[model samples]
Target: MKANKASVEFAKKVSKGTPYKFTIDTLIVDHPLKKVTLSMGESFSYIPFRVEQVPRYNNWYHELLGRRFRNYTVFIESLGKEIHELIPNIYRGESVPLDLFRLSKPLKIKQPIVRNLSKASSYRGGLSNRNIALWHSHGWYYENTQDRWKWQRPRLFTTVEDIWSMGFVVPYITPMLENAGAYCFLPRERDTQKHEIIIDSEGSTKGSVYLEKGDGFKDEEGSGYAMKVPFLVEGENPFQMGKSRRMPVSKETFSTISFIPDIPEEGEYAVYISYKSHEDHVTDAHYTVHHSGGKTSFLVNQTMGGGTWIYLGTFRFNKGYDQAKAMIELANQSDETGQWVSADAVKLGGGMGNVIRG
Candidate 1:
């Protein structure tokens, strides 16, 4: 059987300079015939029927085969927000931690009386994906003024009735893809590129290093320099070649350094920077990381505040290139404006319904 041309082309593109070989497993059909008595030159006929324990085959493509390719694209797009939003933190090597808190006061009812009751119920309700709240009552009693009985009988009351009872209230949680890391490096003395300097540590590393721009090491322009430090290896130390000791960053002081290494493996990395903004907010911003052939690339993005959202999408690459190329490819792929096209084709045939016997 002949292979499809588009599939072949896609294989060629992704295989360019890649060291690893890819093999696609496909499903096969087998026909077993029952024994039949026949004479020489005698012909017989039988109705064709498919026989198998289960309907579908087990395979990655098979499972995903029937699904709308566009829907998959949409899913990846929707999921990209989560992945990209968390990439910065992932690149920084941080994990999502769950924090639970108890409500001290009943939430102020906003809607109409009816809506308020419903809102209150929602807050004092059970666990949910977004947030959860529970309610408990303090034992107390009050006279029912509307009751007409001569003396108000001892009224039975639960804590919920006396005091507003509620439980666990959670914050809006955005999913984070962890272990994402990224890095950008340059030789000791080189022209610094715009948007190329910032890196996302993703809550992974404590600090980053970048080359200082211009020859103002002696002036205010060089007094306290700032650059985006992409995520780097956890234990790998970032230092300048000629500098002997490491300098720590202080409130008003900035230290100049040599190179920042790229992540150790193939994965998503976020962009983050360490700089004192005009508002004096020292933020560790984050953005996603893309790699190709092991070379690092930089995706320029707006600055993010502390605890901002970033999504890191799925990673794919050619292995033949060195770490630097892979890193670059990662950055390029992460560009919010960059386009990513899948290589697989949509299948439509099922059984022998349209088959013809010769």
Candidate 2:
């Protein structure tokens, strides 16, 4: 059994809604049966107001789901169980639905109070924290007794609230992730069409970073070449539908996005775009590569790794910000149905080898 590993880059300001980064140098698969080659082992963070819709809904198998899931809520006459319970006493008095908390039984000792559970260590076993007995991200997780794995440890400890509070910035919730398109994390990128990419601004640059969303999106499963379960490496990608990104369906030759980062740097950087291939949705991502001498465009079939980056190509540029402005598009051929157009992070750096470089 190979454990998936990552090198985390903690943010200097680890506050709520702040973005953190993780670079995954090794592509270790949970099971040998599954081949997970890392094109670029990297991840970032965000306080999820709403997650991408997990397309793997087994609606066909069980028509009677609401009865069993009565713990949830019901809306519009449709019976639905409350799978997640919001953590009380987090923020001020009012609350944000996006800051949903899935706890493992309320904490016995929260802020100000502390108790020595040294003898109680037998109950927690290997689960150790600041002795607060809490996981760092995603507030608290949801689990049941049926979980045969490491589903133990209902902590009685307490820790600082800042550690768990990821700046929860709510974005415009869409039905699908790709319908919103690729991005790095920008606190305010929650505009109707969320689009941007990694790293804090190093210096002043030229062009603005651009991101948008369009048509053509459908729900899918991760069994094939799609996002497999547990895509979340630390605080990123959880294989949840709300966690992925894609390009919208279009009647035009290409639905596009453009931007120039305020932060600037100069160097030769390779572009890595993440994508997933599923049985449904046919999409090909396109981008315009600009350099000192000339510029050209490249394309790749969006369906591939369950949510892994595929190298598109590289370019050379002078030391400046404007020169770093990037524009990537997902071609929406009039004849093509554009069922699946993946729009993920357009990372600029030295990633793994390019899967499809033109």
Candidate 3:
């Protein structure tokens, strides 16, 4: 006695984004029979069957639907008008298992909506493998001296710009960009935590030191200088939990505060400063960053953008805490009179490389 085997193969050659619909035309089988039921040596039979398949691009269609909808709304509403429509929710039928077949009855599957391209795009995957770093305007802060959640920015048109900008970025923009496949990092608090986390404090954040100069320096016992918490419950501080110091601007006497960060690796780091915003804050607050390359000075406007990490230029820093290490010093030497200078926290290590982005 001898045994025989049957084999099947499937092949298709097509370009990308081409629709494929296939159907098997014919199939045949040949076999040998040794049974004495009839005088037969070999038998050949035709097997009638059909294999039908169609491409289902649910993901691409879904993304297209969302993008088109957003574009349409923006274009229509930009003319200082409104478009209203009622979208009803309908329940689809239960899913059918793969093992089951609809032979006697018709099986219908919804195809993706196809539209002609308005413009040819090279990137089929939107923002995939892209890194985006963004931050919301400002956030709420806790004024510990007054024991209340104070608004960091001015309240304009019912809501402050801090919360207003955050309303779009956190809940809307971030998710949309992420859906398009982008890794985003906004160096602010996005959690529901009402308590403050002091990031650059002694023992709280290693390899950092804060030093103060002359008298008239006062430490504000609250966070929001180092970290920013967007949402805050009632009686809960939305500011970053940390201590920030402030002193009166000086011209004759050099009153200064310095924040030094220990660099474990010798590389380029993006310097950022966080400070409090007050009505009579110094307009020309002097800041000097001493890095491996050299000393870079920047005059920051402390009257606005409190509780947010403001980026200074990237600079090269030597490893470890030495005289040539990365250090940020704020001198209370401003031309503005009857104003105060505030210093909260200094951040490093957000740069791309040691190549300076001057």
Worst 10 residues of 2 by lDDT: 74-83
Q: Compose the digit string of candidate 1's lDDT tens values, residues 1-358.
A: 2223323333344344545343322212121321111111101011111222012111222233333221222111011122222222323222432222322455442221111111122322322211211223232333346433232233346323322221211111111101111211211211111112222222111222233322213211111222123333344223210111112223322333223333333333332222212222112112222344232222222222112112223234332323333321111122122222110000111111211211
For candidate 2, give the lDDT of residue 85: 18
True-structure RMSD for candidate 2: 29.0
Poorest 10 consecutive residues by lDDT, candidate 3: 36-45
Q: Spell out the clash pairs found in candidate 3.
A: 223-240, 223-242, 224-240
TM-score of every candidate relative to the true structure: 0.18, 0.32, 0.41
Which candidate number has the best TM-score?
A: 3
Q: Give the per-residue lDDT of model 2 (tens digit) for 58-100.
A: 2211122233332322211001221121123243233234333
TM-score of 2: 0.32
Residue 80 accuracy (lDDT) in model 1: 18
Which regions of candidate 3 deviate over 4 angstroms?
A: 1-204, 221-223, 226-238, 351-358
TM-score of 3: 0.41
RMSD of every prediction: 31.5, 29.0, 24.4
